[model samples]
Target: MPMKPAPDAPLCFHTLIHRLEKLKLNYLEIPAAVVQQLGGTFNIRLQCSVNGAEAFACGLVALGEGRGYITLSSKRMKPQGLQLGQQVAVRLWADTSEFGMEVPEELAELLRQDEEGDRRFRLLPPGKQRYIIYHVSGVKSSQKRLDRALLLINNLKQLPPGKEDFRAMLGLPPREAL
Candidate 1:
């Protein structure tokens, strides 16, 4: 039987953080001590609540030696007036969302309608599935989202199991052909 989902107890932390000089990206570093306290591998998905606000899904990007950081986007920071080089309160919980990300309604409906496509998509690793979902949902137009969903699922169904390539899923020519 599948294991029961853990309770929603967030691991809280207050830390000083900084952004890269050349990039708009900001991140929170999880030290080896914190990693050990969390009792998991360096890389893991998390739902982060910043400054007691709403939670958002993110991943802990590993940096070796049991260290990792969660990237914070400008879109999420500007509204809250968050700045780098400031001490911030963060609460993190394991991300338990299906596919580790939100599935766009268009893709979810398409998958519901296409049994073979759904089967192929479900066979893909969670990260790969997130890639497709992100691509489909990135656009603002509903028609465009539907079009992308159809195109991606159609491309996904054509690839052999265990050999699905990201480029192929996007209907792009192989890198060598470029």
Candidate 2:
């Protein structure tokens, strides 16, 4: 059986009508009152569904003065025929998945088979772990996913604990060099 949401979980959004705003970027404003009702903070991860589209993992980004917004990337908007200034139905739910986002099968299986890799991955901050997971899971090809998972785990293990550098893990030059 699946576990139920905790009593205090900010599991729903009250707003159903919101205009997609574009000021150098596209997003929908989350009312301050709604934010207050959903735990009064902007730090929680969420699963958002727009206009009944499939829910996608996201977070409420602070936009000052107690207001927040979830950005809609063009990649996300285009496929759904989302247009600027259009009204949308946005629903939000508390993200309860481990690691805050869905872990891809390739990465999950690799971590399960490699003890040291899993240990190193767990030692990183949650945000860093999400970054690595996103990188590995963003592609469309299974071979590419496995390749990225292998690359990340191998590079992660090469670094000492508590001293991992994302740039180095991706084989990029030190940030200071750029």
Candidate 3:
């Protein structure tokens, strides 16, 4: 069953952590009317103003029906000792998956360009693909991410399934090759 947001809407902005602490609400359902009320595909930054100071929250968006919900993990903000009617500012914008560590679209495109690339990659065990994706996305800098992604694609073209040259892909010398 789909969960529904309260009509009162908690002021459409803020809800106290203590009030929400024991609430094991997994998913917040936004009605279609609410989506129409707000423009489509918006970004929101959750902010907590506590003790006359404000702090930004690390949050994720969960899309459902026509509306989206900004979910704050407990780690980001503890929902304890929070006062009722506390202000939670939500700043909205378009969503961009590139803001965080994720598989590069360019890498996917590179794989798609080759006739057999997708097949070869798909044939590999899931673990291998996940390892490559993690390694490629783990780099902090954009240049490093791109470089690693290109190297991975090239290595995929050369190596057989189940056999990856991690050192070669990273431009590091292999023990034997060295």
Candidate 4:
């Protein structure tokens, strides 16, 4: 079930920012349970009424533990006006499914034959799987994707779910590392 925002949750601006920073994540996962309520994958724009004005933002709905969190970059204009405990109404939706790559036949078969690989593959939501797929597919005119796929598969085979950072596991440097 989706965790509802409390009616009187205090607007703690610093706390909210702290939490966001603590996550140390570039993306936030939207729980699968709430995906439907937010219009599944159709709606893209979210409106938050703030300070007597409407603040609009673009976001991606990602899969979380049990429910989805509507994720917006802190760099967005809407985020600028947000305080910790404001009662802003958010209207959101998933916008696109074009970010990931198709599972290659050879890789698919390899995954199928390896029990651990199969388990990891099954555990990932379609969006995450698509993310990996698309990432692997994005390297054009080189064998980068193939190399990435091999590294990803090996990492998934070694790391448990909560510990995996698909980016780091693929041996990519952190944003700051670049």
Highest lDDT, which number? 1
Q: Tens-digit lDDT track for model 4 on 48-113?
A: 323334443334444444344444444542444654443443433222323233465545666777
Best to worst by TM-score, what's the order?
Answer: 2, 1, 4, 3
| lDDT to native, each model | 0.82, 0.80, 0.49, 0.50
Model 4: how far residue 159 lies from native, Å: 1.5
Could you tell me which 10 consecutive residues in candidate 2 have the lowest summed lDDT? 1-10
Per-model TM values vs. the true structure: 0.83, 0.84, 0.38, 0.39
Name the runs in model 2 displaced over 4 angstroms.
Answer: 1-24
Model 1: per-residue Cα lDDT over 100-133, one tens digit each: 7788899999999999999999999888888999
Cα distance off (Å), candidate 4, residue 132: 0.9
Q: State the lDDT of candidate 2 residue by residue for 1-178, as single tens digits.
A: 2233353453455342344435666776788766766666876787888878888888787877888888778888889897777777777777888888999999999999999999999999988999999999899998999999999889999988888888877877788999
lDDT of 1 at 164: 91
Instruction: List residue ranges in candidate 1 displaced over 4 A.
Output: 1-5, 20-25
Could you tell me which 10 consecutive residues in candidate 3 have the lowest summed lDDT?
92-101
Which is the leading candidate under TM-score?
2
Q: Compose the digit string of candidate 3's lDDT tens values, residues 87-119.
A: 444332222333222456656676678657666
In model 3, the runs with Cα more than 4 Å from the true position are 1-102, 171-173, 176-178
What is the full ranking by lDDT, best candidate first? 1, 2, 4, 3
Flag the better candidate by TM-score, 1 or 2: 2
